[model samples]
Target: MWQNKFETRLELEPRPSRYLLIYQIVLHTLAGAALLLPLILPAGVAFVLLATAGGSLLWQVWRHYREGRGTTRLIWRTDGAWDYQIGVQYWPDLSLLPSTYITRGLIILHLQPVKGRRLYRVLLPDSLPKEQWHLLWLRLRYAGFSEEDVGVKG
Candidate 1:
């Protein structure tokens, strides 16, 4: 008989990616420009409007940056047991959730929030790995959840 050994450590590594840094820089530059546009405009009203828009964009950009920094850590194990820390913005009416896997080892799973009874918009990742998706499916099945409970849109 053959067996596999497992090691627990960060899977994606800790180094910052150049692509991600570049993207962040571009986003901040755009926000800065937006904030500056209002000041450059000739009229007060136009300046005020642009400034407000820029301020909102700047706030959004900063929030996005914080989230990226916070979620930089990824966890994985050689035995296939893995869990990634993920989060979504608040929705007034709806709640979003990601499905989880029960076992570990070379697994991919789809994580999505469950819809709330009330109406609210929830943004979810477009696609997750098929292996994780299947693991989530089996876990849900084992938990006695119906197919409807595991349905992911987006």
Candidate 2:
């Protein structure tokens, strides 16, 4: 049996990648278009939908910016436990292994907390060396997650 000696620490400060910027622009544009639906549909119904969608979009954007602006610290202990902290917020210990989603040059970590799931998006900027990114991924995989837990966007 192979005993794993896992002890690593990583600090990540994600920047806005071009792909992320484009995606955000497209998403906000779609939401803006939905706001015009009141012209076609019943005013009351359209207003409700518009409000819901707009609020949801704004909330998502706010959360994204908040997560991206800070330095996220991840620690993998030899005891097979993980610690994640962003800014002053210390997230609860991950009850379940995280799933990874790769899309448009961004890697998203979907962490299953005690309650629901939370997403941490890492925007891969061109300035970041590919070697470092590979090392980070390898460390994450070695910590326990497997390829089966990864999903790639088409």
Candidate 3:
């Protein structure tokens, strides 16, 4: 209970990250190219595969981010509870799993709802202002992944 208590609540508004979109596109494109550079597949086969993969990736990205699809709200409670909201849907019992990866530039929140499927939310430096981003990173590091909190060793 000691760790859960805090002076003020922390809430964040996460927006779509163009950096992540660009990163995914370039990474996927390079992977597709690499699959062919070794000549594992015939030239014709590789071209077809690469084009198909690239096209699908673009479509998926467009759909996920169109019309502010990636924008969401996150509330961090003093009792160490989290609430997630997107559009008109809200999940009050969404738990932040320990597998989350956080850095100064990025955060991948592995979240699970009490009654629904698990999901991962991407938080990027550009998602918030510099000060808020820093505060979020600090809270995640100390409250979310602290050794005394999550009981992860090594």
Give the candidate number with the greatest lDDT: 3
lDDT by residue for model 1 over 1-154, one digit each (tens)? Answer: 0022234332331222344445556775676566565465567666676567666656766665665565432343344333344454332211223343223222223332244232222222122244444543343344333435434331
lDDT of 3 by residue, 1-154 (tens): 2245567878888777778777888888887868767786688888888888888788869865673654578887777767888887788866777777776677887778878888778778887778888887877777545655443322
Any idea what lDDT model 2 has? Answer: 0.58
Cα-based lDDT for every prediction? 0.40, 0.58, 0.74
TM-score, ranked from best to worst = 3, 2, 1
**Winner on TM-score (1 vs 3):** 3
Q: Report the lDDT of model 2 for residue 25.
A: 58
Q: Give the TM-score of candidate 3.
A: 0.77
Model 3 residue 68 lDDT score: 67
Give the local distance difference test score of model 1. 0.40
